[model samples]
Target: MRIELQNTFVELRGEQNPVASAVLDALRSNGATVGAVAPVPDILIVSLPLLPVAGYDPATQLQSAMATGEAMFARGSGRVLFLVSAAAGMPMRRHAEFSVAMAGVLATVRTMAMQLGPKVLVNALGVGAIGEKVVAGDAAMLGHASVKRPGTVAEVADTALFFCDPLNSYTTGQMLSVDGGWSAGYGRNF
Candidate 1:
Protein backbone atom coordinates (compact mmCIF):
# COMPACT_ATOMS: atom_id res chain seq x y z
CA MET A 1 0.00 0.00 0.00
CA ARG A 2 1.92 3.00 -1.21
CA ILE A 3 0.52 6.23 0.18
CA GLU A 4 1.39 9.82 -0.70
CA LEU A 5 0.02 11.94 2.13
CA GLN A 6 -0.26 15.55 1.06
CA ASN A 7 -0.96 18.27 3.66
CA THR A 8 -3.13 20.92 2.03
CA PHE A 9 -4.08 22.88 5.14
CA VAL A 10 -2.26 26.17 5.34
CA GLU A 11 -1.98 27.93 8.67
CA LEU A 12 -3.76 31.25 8.94
CA ARG A 13 -0.98 32.68 11.12
CA GLY A 14 2.06 31.19 9.39
CA GLU A 15 4.64 33.64 8.21
CA GLN A 16 5.45 31.61 5.11
CA ASN A 17 4.27 28.36 3.56
CA PRO A 18 6.61 27.39 0.78
CA VAL A 19 6.60 23.77 1.86
CA ALA A 20 3.66 22.67 -0.23
CA SER A 21 4.71 24.76 -3.20
CA ALA A 22 8.24 23.44 -2.99
CA VAL A 23 6.90 19.92 -2.76
CA LEU A 24 4.85 20.40 -5.88
CA ASP A 25 7.83 21.81 -7.70
CA ALA A 26 9.93 18.90 -6.54
CA LEU A 27 7.40 16.48 -7.91
CA ARG A 28 7.18 18.31 -11.21
CA SER A 29 10.91 18.66 -11.66
CA ASN A 30 11.71 15.16 -10.52
CA GLY A 31 9.00 13.78 -12.81
CA ALA A 32 6.54 10.96 -12.17
CA THR A 33 9.11 8.38 -11.08
CA VAL A 34 8.93 9.99 -7.62
CA GLY A 35 5.98 8.06 -6.24
CA ALA A 36 7.20 4.49 -6.42
CA VAL A 37 5.95 2.25 -3.62
CA ALA A 38 7.48 -1.17 -4.29
CA PRO A 39 11.05 -0.07 -3.92
CA VAL A 40 9.56 3.00 -2.25
CA PRO A 41 11.44 6.21 -2.79
CA ASP A 42 14.12 6.99 -0.23
CA ILE A 43 11.77 9.44 1.48
CA LEU A 44 8.17 9.96 2.54
CA ILE A 45 7.10 13.46 3.51
CA VAL A 46 4.16 13.81 5.94
CA SER A 47 2.91 17.36 6.40
CA LEU A 48 0.87 17.66 9.56
CA PRO A 49 -1.57 20.45 10.40
CA LEU A 50 -0.38 23.67 12.04
CA LEU A 51 -2.32 25.13 14.95
CA PRO A 52 -2.10 28.63 16.34
CA VAL A 53 -1.32 29.64 19.96
CA ALA A 54 -4.90 30.77 20.55
CA GLY A 55 -8.12 29.25 19.21
CA TYR A 56 -6.78 26.30 17.19
CA ASP A 57 -7.07 22.68 18.29
CA PRO A 58 -4.03 20.36 18.45
CA ALA A 59 -5.00 17.19 20.30
CA THR A 60 -7.35 15.73 17.75
CA GLN A 61 -5.24 16.88 14.84
CA LEU A 62 -2.04 15.44 16.28
CA GLN A 63 -3.66 12.14 17.09
CA SER A 64 -5.10 11.79 13.61
CA ALA A 65 -1.77 12.67 12.00
CA MET A 66 0.12 10.25 14.21
CA ALA A 67 -2.30 7.48 13.45
CA THR A 68 -1.85 8.11 9.73
CA GLY A 69 1.91 7.91 10.10
CA GLU A 70 1.66 4.78 12.21
CA ALA A 71 -0.48 3.11 9.59
CA MET A 72 2.02 4.09 6.90
CA PHE A 73 4.86 2.64 8.94
CA ALA A 74 2.96 -0.62 9.29
CA ARG A 75 3.05 -0.96 5.51
CA GLY A 76 6.86 -0.87 5.67
CA SER A 77 8.95 0.74 2.94
CA GLY A 78 10.63 4.13 3.19
CA ARG A 79 11.69 6.87 5.57
CA VAL A 80 9.09 9.23 7.09
CA LEU A 81 9.65 12.95 7.51
CA PHE A 82 7.25 14.23 10.15
CA LEU A 83 6.99 17.98 9.54
CA VAL A 84 6.39 19.69 12.88
CA SER A 85 7.41 23.23 13.87
CA ALA A 86 9.39 25.21 16.46
CA ALA A 87 6.04 26.60 17.55
CA ALA A 88 5.62 23.26 19.24
CA GLY A 89 8.46 24.37 21.51
CA MET A 90 7.31 27.95 21.92
CA PRO A 91 6.58 29.48 25.34
CA MET A 92 2.96 29.08 26.30
CA ARG A 93 1.73 32.61 26.85
CA ARG A 94 -1.98 31.86 27.05
CA HIS A 95 -2.22 28.09 27.26
CA ALA A 96 -0.06 24.95 27.23
CA GLU A 97 -2.38 23.20 24.84
CA PHE A 98 0.01 23.17 21.86
CA SER A 99 2.84 21.84 23.99
CA VAL A 100 0.71 19.01 25.32
CA ALA A 101 -0.57 18.25 21.84
CA MET A 102 2.88 18.07 20.24
CA ALA A 103 4.13 15.97 23.14
CA GLY A 104 1.59 13.34 22.32
CA VAL A 105 2.46 13.38 18.63
CA LEU A 106 6.17 13.18 19.35
CA ALA A 107 5.62 10.30 21.71
CA THR A 108 3.67 8.42 19.09
CA VAL A 109 6.40 8.93 16.51
CA ARG A 110 9.09 7.73 18.90
CA THR A 111 7.18 4.63 19.93
CA MET A 112 6.32 3.74 16.35
CA ALA A 113 9.90 4.24 15.26
CA MET A 114 11.11 1.80 17.92
CA GLN A 115 8.62 -0.84 16.94
CA LEU A 116 9.06 -0.46 13.16
CA GLY A 117 12.81 -1.21 12.84
CA PRO A 118 15.64 0.10 10.62
CA LYS A 119 13.94 -0.07 7.25
CA VAL A 120 11.52 2.62 8.34
CA LEU A 121 13.24 5.68 9.73
CA VAL A 122 11.06 8.28 11.45
CA ASN A 123 12.29 11.86 11.89
CA ALA A 124 10.85 15.33 12.43
CA LEU A 125 11.65 18.72 10.93
CA GLY A 126 11.28 21.45 13.57
CA VAL A 127 10.94 24.76 11.76
CA GLY A 128 12.28 27.93 13.30
CA ALA A 129 10.64 31.32 13.08
CA ILE A 130 10.51 32.30 9.45
CA GLY A 131 9.94 35.84 8.25
CA GLU A 132 6.42 35.75 6.88
CA LYS A 133 3.74 38.38 6.83
CA VAL A 134 1.35 36.31 8.89
CA VAL A 135 3.65 36.29 11.90
CA ALA A 136 4.73 39.91 11.56
CA GLY A 137 2.49 40.92 14.42
CA ASP A 138 4.21 38.47 16.76
CA ALA A 139 7.73 39.78 16.25
CA ALA A 140 8.31 40.07 19.98
CA MET A 141 7.81 36.37 20.54
CA LEU A 142 9.95 35.41 17.55
CA GLY A 143 12.75 37.70 18.68
CA HIS A 144 14.17 34.97 20.87
CA ALA A 145 15.02 32.72 17.96
CA SER A 146 18.76 31.96 17.96
CA VAL A 147 19.45 33.50 14.59
CA LYS A 148 16.97 36.21 15.46
CA ARG A 149 16.28 36.12 11.73
CA PRO A 150 13.59 34.15 10.03
CA GLY A 151 14.50 30.99 8.07
CA THR A 152 14.29 30.68 4.31
CA VAL A 153 12.34 28.22 2.24
CA ALA A 154 15.58 26.90 0.75
CA GLU A 155 17.00 26.18 4.19
CA VAL A 156 13.97 24.16 5.19
CA ALA A 157 13.98 22.33 1.87
CA ASP A 158 17.65 21.52 2.27
CA THR A 159 17.11 20.00 5.69
CA ALA A 160 14.25 17.96 4.33
CA LEU A 161 16.48 16.74 1.53
CA PHE A 162 19.18 15.71 3.99
CA PHE A 163 16.78 13.64 6.07
CA CYS A 164 15.30 11.96 3.03
CA ASP A 165 18.63 11.21 1.44
CA PRO A 166 19.51 7.53 1.12
CA LEU A 167 22.91 8.28 2.62
CA ASN A 168 21.24 9.34 5.88
CA SER A 169 20.59 5.77 7.01
CA TYR A 170 22.23 5.99 10.40
CA THR A 171 19.89 8.66 11.84
CA THR A 172 16.42 7.77 13.04
CA GLY A 173 13.85 8.53 15.73
CA GLN A 174 15.31 12.04 16.07
CA MET A 175 13.91 15.57 16.15
CA LEU A 176 16.11 17.90 14.16
CA SER A 177 15.59 21.51 15.29
CA VAL A 178 16.31 23.96 12.48
CA ASP A 179 15.40 26.95 14.61
CA GLY A 180 18.63 28.91 14.13
CA GLY A 181 19.70 28.58 17.78
CA TRP A 182 16.55 29.38 19.72
CA SER A 183 16.26 25.92 21.25
CA ALA A 184 19.75 26.28 22.74
CA GLY A 185 19.65 29.63 24.56
CA TYR A 186 18.34 29.88 28.11
CA GLY A 187 17.41 33.46 29.09
CA ARG A 188 16.35 34.35 25.52
CA ASN A 189 18.09 37.10 23.51
CA PHE A 190 20.42 34.75 21.67
Candidate 2:
Protein backbone atom coordinates (compact mmCIF):
# COMPACT_ATOMS: atom_id res chain seq x y z
CA MET A 1 0.00 0.00 0.00
CA ARG A 2 1.27 3.45 -0.88
CA ILE A 3 1.27 6.13 1.85
CA GLU A 4 2.01 9.84 1.77
CA LEU A 5 2.97 11.76 4.84
CA GLN A 6 2.32 15.47 4.25
CA ASN A 7 3.99 18.21 6.27
CA THR A 8 6.07 15.55 7.97
CA PHE A 9 8.97 16.68 10.11
CA VAL A 10 10.95 13.93 8.40
CA GLU A 11 11.39 16.24 5.40
CA LEU A 12 12.98 18.86 7.65
CA ARG A 13 14.68 16.92 10.44
CA GLY A 14 14.89 13.59 8.60
CA GLU A 15 14.14 11.43 11.67
CA GLN A 16 16.23 13.62 13.98
CA ASN A 17 12.97 14.26 15.77
CA PRO A 18 11.87 11.24 17.74
CA VAL A 19 8.28 11.51 16.54
CA ALA A 20 9.35 11.53 12.91
CA SER A 21 11.61 8.60 13.52
CA ALA A 22 8.87 6.61 15.19
CA VAL A 23 6.38 7.33 12.41
CA LEU A 24 8.81 6.22 9.74
CA ASP A 25 9.65 3.11 11.69
CA ALA A 26 6.02 2.21 12.15
CA LEU A 27 5.26 2.56 8.45
CA ARG A 28 8.29 0.53 7.48
CA SER A 29 7.49 -2.18 10.00
CA ASN A 30 4.02 -2.52 8.59
CA GLY A 31 5.62 -3.38 5.24
CA ALA A 32 3.94 -0.48 3.51
CA THR A 33 5.65 1.59 0.83
CA VAL A 34 6.36 5.06 2.10
CA GLY A 35 6.41 8.23 -0.07
CA ALA A 36 5.21 6.43 -3.14
CA VAL A 37 2.77 8.05 -5.58
CA ALA A 38 -0.36 6.25 -6.68
CA PRO A 39 -3.69 7.03 -8.28
CA VAL A 40 -5.15 7.04 -4.76
CA PRO A 41 -2.90 6.67 -1.78
CA ASP A 42 -3.86 4.16 0.91
CA ILE A 43 -3.11 6.66 3.67
CA LEU A 44 -2.42 10.38 3.99
CA ILE A 45 -0.88 11.63 7.21
CA VAL A 46 -1.16 15.38 7.73
CA SER A 47 1.24 16.61 10.38
CA LEU A 48 0.56 20.15 11.56
CA PRO A 49 3.62 22.27 12.07
CA LEU A 50 3.85 24.65 15.00
CA LEU A 51 3.20 27.87 13.10
CA PRO A 52 3.88 31.20 14.77
CA VAL A 53 0.28 32.30 14.78
CA ALA A 54 0.58 34.15 18.07
CA GLY A 55 -0.33 37.83 17.61
CA TYR A 56 -0.88 37.05 13.95
CA ASP A 57 -4.14 37.82 12.23
CA PRO A 58 -6.89 35.24 12.60
CA ALA A 59 -7.47 35.18 8.86
CA THR A 60 -3.91 34.08 8.31
CA GLN A 61 -4.30 31.26 10.77
CA LEU A 62 -7.45 30.01 9.09
CA GLN A 63 -5.93 30.37 5.66
CA SER A 64 -2.85 28.43 6.65
CA ALA A 65 -4.88 25.44 7.88
CA MET A 66 -7.37 25.61 5.03
CA ALA A 67 -4.65 25.71 2.44
CA THR A 68 -2.80 22.82 3.98
CA GLY A 69 -5.92 20.68 4.30
CA GLU A 70 -6.98 21.45 0.76
CA ALA A 71 -3.60 20.55 -0.60
CA MET A 72 -3.49 17.26 1.30
CA PHE A 73 -7.01 16.35 0.21
CA ALA A 74 -6.16 17.08 -3.36
CA ARG A 75 -3.12 14.84 -3.23
CA GLY A 76 -4.70 11.46 -2.39
CA SER A 77 -7.62 9.38 -1.33
CA GLY A 78 -8.40 6.63 1.23
CA ARG A 79 -7.65 7.52 4.87
CA VAL A 80 -6.39 10.83 6.31
CA LEU A 81 -4.73 11.23 9.70
CA PHE A 82 -4.33 14.79 10.95
CA LEU A 83 -1.65 15.10 13.57
CA VAL A 84 -1.90 18.18 15.79
CA SER A 85 -0.83 19.39 19.23
CA ALA A 86 -3.04 18.88 22.27
CA ALA A 87 -2.80 22.58 22.99
CA ALA A 88 -5.70 22.86 20.58
CA GLY A 89 -8.01 21.62 23.31
CA MET A 90 -6.05 22.71 26.37
CA PRO A 91 -6.23 26.06 28.13
CA MET A 92 -2.58 26.86 27.69
CA ARG A 93 -1.87 30.41 28.77
CA ARG A 94 1.39 30.70 26.86
CA HIS A 95 -0.09 29.15 23.74
CA ALA A 96 -3.54 30.75 23.67
CA GLU A 97 -3.57 31.80 20.03
CA PHE A 98 -1.93 28.61 18.95
CA SER A 99 -4.52 26.60 20.86
CA VAL A 100 -7.33 28.47 19.17
CA ALA A 101 -5.86 28.08 15.72
CA MET A 102 -5.33 24.38 16.19
CA ALA A 103 -8.85 24.00 17.47
CA GLY A 104 -10.05 25.56 14.25
CA VAL A 105 -7.97 23.10 12.32
CA LEU A 106 -9.54 20.24 14.26
CA ALA A 107 -12.95 21.54 13.32
CA THR A 108 -11.88 21.51 9.72
CA VAL A 109 -10.88 17.89 10.07
CA ARG A 110 -14.31 17.08 11.39
CA THR A 111 -15.94 18.87 8.50
CA MET A 112 -13.74 17.10 6.04
CA ALA A 113 -14.57 13.75 7.59
CA MET A 114 -18.26 14.47 7.18
CA GLN A 115 -17.82 15.66 3.63
CA LEU A 116 -15.48 12.90 2.57
CA GLY A 117 -17.40 10.22 4.42
CA PRO A 118 -17.10 6.47 3.59
CA LYS A 119 -14.74 7.46 0.80
CA VAL A 120 -12.00 9.14 2.82
CA LEU A 121 -11.71 8.41 6.53
CA VAL A 122 -10.38 11.64 8.05
CA ASN A 123 -9.33 11.74 11.71
CA ALA A 124 -6.94 13.57 14.02
CA LEU A 125 -4.31 12.70 16.58
CA GLY A 126 -3.69 15.36 19.22
CA VAL A 127 -0.32 15.03 20.85
CA GLY A 128 0.44 16.29 24.35
CA ALA A 129 3.67 17.50 25.95
CA ILE A 130 6.04 14.93 24.55
CA GLY A 131 9.54 14.61 25.88
CA GLU A 132 12.21 12.07 26.65
CA LYS A 133 11.44 12.56 30.33
CA VAL A 134 8.62 14.31 32.11
CA VAL A 135 10.03 17.29 33.88
CA ALA A 136 8.27 18.84 36.86
CA GLY A 137 7.44 21.87 34.78
CA ASP A 138 5.94 19.74 32.02
CA ALA A 139 3.99 17.64 34.47
CA ALA A 140 2.68 20.75 36.14
CA MET A 141 0.98 21.85 32.94
CA LEU A 142 -0.35 18.37 32.34
CA GLY A 143 -1.15 17.58 35.96
CA HIS A 144 -4.70 16.84 35.03
CA ALA A 145 -3.71 13.93 32.86
CA SER A 146 -4.32 10.53 34.34
CA VAL A 147 -0.96 9.37 33.11
CA LYS A 148 0.59 12.47 34.67
CA ARG A 149 3.53 12.28 32.31
CA PRO A 150 4.67 13.54 28.98
CA GLY A 151 3.86 11.32 26.00
CA THR A 152 6.45 9.60 23.87
CA VAL A 153 6.98 9.55 20.11
CA ALA A 154 6.37 5.84 20.09
CA GLU A 155 3.01 6.31 21.77
CA VAL A 156 1.99 8.88 19.18
CA ALA A 157 3.11 6.66 16.33
CA ASP A 158 1.20 3.68 17.68
CA THR A 159 -2.00 5.66 17.79
CA ALA A 160 -1.39 7.01 14.30
CA LEU A 161 -1.03 3.50 12.98
CA PHE A 162 -4.40 2.54 14.41
CA PHE A 163 -6.13 5.46 12.76
CA CYS A 164 -4.32 5.10 9.47
CA ASP A 165 -4.77 1.36 9.22
CA PRO A 166 -6.51 0.35 6.04
CA LEU A 167 -8.29 -2.63 7.55
CA ASN A 168 -9.67 -0.50 10.35
CA SER A 169 -12.62 1.00 8.60
CA TYR A 170 -15.67 2.73 10.22
CA THR A 171 -13.63 5.19 12.33
CA THR A 172 -13.81 8.78 11.10
CA GLY A 173 -14.56 12.35 12.13
CA GLN A 174 -12.89 11.52 15.40
CA MET A 175 -10.09 13.37 17.21
CA LEU A 176 -8.22 10.85 19.33
CA SER A 177 -6.07 12.46 22.01
CA VAL A 178 -2.91 10.53 22.59
CA ASP A 179 -2.54 12.94 25.50
CA GLY A 180 -2.61 10.62 28.49
CA GLY A 181 -6.18 11.62 29.25
CA TRP A 182 -5.37 15.29 29.75
CA SER A 183 -8.26 16.31 27.53
CA ALA A 184 -10.53 14.05 29.54
CA GLY A 185 -10.41 15.92 32.90
CA TYR A 186 -8.40 16.77 35.99
CA GLY A 187 -6.80 13.49 37.03
CA ARG A 188 -4.45 14.92 39.60
CA ASN A 189 -3.10 12.05 41.63
CA PHE A 190 -3.77 13.64 44.94
Candidate 3:
Protein backbone atom coordinates (compact mmCIF):
# COMPACT_ATOMS: atom_id res chain seq x y z
CA MET A 1 0.00 0.00 0.00
CA ARG A 2 1.45 3.33 -1.09
CA ILE A 3 0.05 6.71 -0.13
CA GLU A 4 0.58 10.23 -1.37
CA LEU A 5 0.75 12.63 1.59
CA GLN A 6 0.79 15.82 -0.39
CA ASN A 7 -0.33 18.94 1.47
CA THR A 8 -0.97 16.93 4.61
CA PHE A 9 0.08 18.53 7.89
CA VAL A 10 1.63 16.03 10.32
CA GLU A 11 2.86 16.36 13.89
CA LEU A 12 5.35 13.95 15.51
CA ARG A 13 5.56 13.38 19.26
CA GLY A 14 8.92 11.67 19.62
CA GLU A 15 11.13 13.46 17.13
CA GLN A 16 14.28 12.38 18.98
CA ASN A 17 13.71 8.72 18.14
CA PRO A 18 15.30 7.07 15.11
CA VAL A 19 11.96 5.69 13.93
CA ALA A 20 10.42 9.14 14.25
CA SER A 21 13.28 10.57 12.20
CA ALA A 22 12.62 8.00 9.52
CA VAL A 23 8.89 8.76 9.58
CA LEU A 24 9.61 12.48 9.31
CA ASP A 25 11.88 11.89 6.36
CA ALA A 26 9.32 9.68 4.69
CA LEU A 27 6.52 12.19 5.28
CA ARG A 28 8.64 14.95 3.75
CA SER A 29 9.73 12.78 0.85
CA ASN A 30 6.08 12.04 0.18
CA GLY A 31 5.22 15.78 0.22
CA ALA A 32 3.66 15.99 3.68
CA THR A 33 4.20 19.22 5.62
CA VAL A 34 5.91 18.17 8.90
CA GLY A 35 7.20 20.43 11.66
CA ALA A 36 6.61 21.47 15.25
CA VAL A 37 3.25 20.82 16.87
CA ALA A 38 0.35 22.35 15.01
CA PRO A 39 -2.75 23.15 17.07
CA VAL A 40 -4.62 20.77 14.85
CA PRO A 41 -2.69 18.43 12.60
CA ASP A 42 -4.04 16.38 9.77
CA ILE A 43 -2.08 13.45 11.15
CA LEU A 44 -0.46 13.02 14.54
CA ILE A 45 2.25 10.36 14.86
CA VAL A 46 3.54 9.37 18.28
CA SER A 47 6.67 7.18 18.50
CA LEU A 48 6.94 5.36 21.83
CA PRO A 49 10.32 3.71 22.41
CA LEU A 50 10.76 0.41 24.31
CA LEU A 51 14.19 1.19 25.68
CA PRO A 52 14.42 0.89 29.44
CA VAL A 53 15.81 4.10 30.79
CA ALA A 54 16.83 4.80 34.35
CA GLY A 55 14.43 7.08 36.20
CA TYR A 56 11.89 6.73 33.40
CA ASP A 57 8.27 6.90 34.39
CA PRO A 58 5.98 4.33 32.76
CA ALA A 59 2.90 6.54 32.68
CA THR A 60 4.69 9.26 30.71
CA GLN A 61 4.26 7.68 27.28
CA LEU A 62 0.62 6.83 27.80
CA GLN A 63 -0.16 10.25 29.24
CA SER A 64 1.65 12.04 26.48
CA ALA A 65 -0.23 10.16 23.79
CA MET A 66 -3.57 10.86 25.48
CA ALA A 67 -2.84 14.54 26.04
CA THR A 68 -1.57 15.08 22.52
CA GLY A 69 -4.40 13.11 20.98
CA GLU A 70 -6.92 15.16 22.93
CA ALA A 71 -5.72 18.38 21.31
CA MET A 72 -6.51 17.10 17.82
CA PHE A 73 -9.44 19.04 16.37
CA ALA A 74 -11.09 18.60 12.97
CA ARG A 75 -13.73 16.08 13.77
CA GLY A 76 -14.37 13.65 10.91
CA SER A 77 -10.81 14.21 9.67
CA GLY A 78 -7.76 13.25 11.71
CA ARG A 79 -5.44 10.27 12.23
CA VAL A 80 -3.42 9.32 15.30
CA LEU A 81 -0.62 6.82 14.83
CA PHE A 82 1.37 5.47 17.76
CA LEU A 83 4.59 3.52 17.28
CA VAL A 84 4.76 1.26 20.32
CA SER A 85 6.40 -2.05 21.28
CA ALA A 86 5.34 -5.42 19.87
CA ALA A 87 5.57 -6.81 23.37
CA ALA A 88 2.17 -5.35 23.95
CA GLY A 89 0.70 -8.32 22.13
CA MET A 90 3.29 -11.00 22.75
CA PRO A 91 4.58 -10.25 26.18
CA MET A 92 8.33 -10.17 26.80
CA ARG A 93 8.87 -12.12 29.98
CA ARG A 94 12.05 -10.24 30.71
CA HIS A 95 10.51 -6.85 30.13
CA ALA A 96 7.34 -7.08 32.15
CA GLU A 97 7.05 -3.37 32.71
CA PHE A 98 7.41 -2.52 29.06
CA SER A 99 4.87 -5.14 28.13
CA VAL A 100 2.30 -3.90 30.61
CA ALA A 101 2.76 -0.28 29.62
CA MET A 102 2.35 -0.84 25.91
CA ALA A 103 -0.71 -3.02 26.53
CA GLY A 104 -2.33 0.08 27.98
CA VAL A 105 -1.46 2.01 24.86
CA LEU A 106 -3.07 -0.58 22.65
CA ALA A 107 -6.16 -0.51 24.85
CA THR A 108 -6.21 3.27 24.65
CA VAL A 109 -6.06 3.06 20.91
CA ARG A 110 -9.06 0.78 20.86
CA THR A 111 -11.00 2.81 23.40
CA MET A 112 -10.19 6.13 21.78
CA ALA A 113 -11.09 4.82 18.38
CA MET A 114 -14.46 3.81 19.74
CA GLN A 115 -14.91 7.15 21.43
CA LEU A 116 -13.88 9.16 18.36
CA GLY A 117 -15.16 6.85 15.67
CA PRO A 118 -15.88 8.00 12.11
CA LYS A 119 -14.31 11.29 13.11
CA VAL A 120 -10.68 10.50 14.05
CA LEU A 121 -8.70 7.33 13.58
CA VAL A 122 -6.59 5.98 16.45
CA ASN A 123 -4.06 3.20 15.83
CA ALA A 124 -0.67 1.91 16.87
CA LEU A 125 2.41 0.32 15.31
CA GLY A 126 3.85 -2.54 17.33
CA VAL A 127 7.59 -2.14 16.80
CA GLY A 128 10.17 -4.81 17.55
CA ALA A 129 13.96 -4.65 17.55
CA ILE A 130 14.12 -1.48 15.51
CA GLY A 131 17.88 -0.83 15.81
CA GLU A 132 17.91 -1.43 19.53
CA LYS A 133 20.89 -3.77 19.55
CA VAL A 134 21.87 -2.48 22.93
CA VAL A 135 18.88 -4.16 24.57
CA ALA A 136 20.65 -7.12 26.17
CA GLY A 137 17.57 -9.33 26.51
CA ASP A 138 16.78 -8.78 22.87
CA ALA A 139 20.35 -9.28 21.67
CA ALA A 140 19.24 -11.94 19.16
CA MET A 141 16.33 -9.99 17.86
CA LEU A 142 16.83 -11.37 14.39
CA GLY A 143 16.86 -14.92 15.70
CA HIS A 144 13.79 -14.35 17.80
CA ALA A 145 11.82 -12.89 14.96
CA SER A 146 10.29 -15.20 12.38
CA VAL A 147 11.79 -13.13 9.58
CA LYS A 148 15.20 -13.62 11.15
CA ARG A 149 16.06 -9.95 11.01
CA PRO A 150 15.58 -6.76 12.85
CA GLY A 151 12.99 -4.39 11.34
CA THR A 152 14.22 -1.32 9.53
CA VAL A 153 13.21 2.27 10.14
CA ALA A 154 12.13 2.63 6.52
CA GLU A 155 9.70 -0.25 6.87
CA VAL A 156 8.24 1.31 9.99
CA ALA A 157 7.94 4.62 8.18
CA ASP A 158 6.11 2.98 5.34
CA THR A 159 3.66 1.36 7.73
CA ALA A 160 3.24 4.65 9.55
CA LEU A 161 2.28 6.30 6.29
CA PHE A 162 -0.29 3.60 5.68
CA PHE A 163 -1.93 4.27 9.03
CA CYS A 164 -1.75 8.03 8.66
CA ASP A 165 -3.02 8.02 5.12
CA PRO A 166 -6.54 9.17 4.37
CA LEU A 167 -7.27 5.88 2.67
CA ASN A 168 -6.99 4.06 6.00
CA SER A 169 -10.44 5.07 7.09
CA TYR A 170 -11.55 1.55 7.94
CA THR A 171 -8.57 0.55 10.07
CA THR A 172 -8.75 2.22 13.45
CA GLY A 173 -8.30 1.02 17.04
CA GLN A 174 -5.78 -1.49 15.68
CA MET A 175 -2.11 -2.26 16.20
CA LEU A 176 -0.08 -3.25 13.18
CA SER A 177 3.15 -5.10 13.92
CA VAL A 178 6.19 -3.80 12.05
CA ASP A 179 8.65 -6.13 13.76
CA GLY A 180 9.43 -8.67 11.04
CA GLY A 181 6.44 -10.76 12.13
CA TRP A 182 7.56 -11.17 15.69
CA SER A 183 4.19 -10.33 17.17
CA ALA A 184 2.20 -12.50 14.80
CA GLY A 185 2.28 -15.94 16.45
CA TYR A 186 5.93 -16.12 15.47
CA GLY A 187 8.23 -15.11 18.30
CA ARG A 188 8.12 -16.24 21.95
CA ASN A 189 5.09 -18.45 21.51
CA PHE A 190 6.78 -21.64 20.50
Range of the 10 consecutive residues with the lowest summed lDDT in candidate 2: 7-16
The whole-model lDDT of each prediction reads 0.53, 0.61, 0.72
TM-score for candidate 1: 0.69
Instruction: Give the per-residue lDDT of model 2 (tens digit) for 1-190.
Output: 3343342322111113455556668876666556644434456566664322365334454454444445556654466666766766654566667777778768877887887665667787777767756411134556777787777778888887787666678998888887787777763332
Ranking of all candidate structures by their lDDT, best first: 3, 2, 1
lDDT accuracy of residue 117 in candidate 1? 57
Worst window of 10 by summed lDDT in candidate 3: 132-141
lDDT score at residue 106, model 1, on the 0-100 scale:
63
Residue-level lDDT tens digits of model 3 in 1-190: 4678887888887636777788889888888899864567888887776553333344666677666566663344678888777766677766777677767778888987887767788998887877645321254445677777676788888888888777667998998887776666443532
Residue 130, candidate 3: alpha-carbon lDDT = 72
For residues 8-117, write the lDDT of model 1, one tens digit per residue: 11111112246534543443343323433333343456554433454445455545444545555666555666666555555434335655555555665676578655
Better of 2 and 3 by lDDT: 3
Best by the lDDT measure: 3
The C-alpha local distance difference test score for the whole of candidate 1 amounts to 0.53
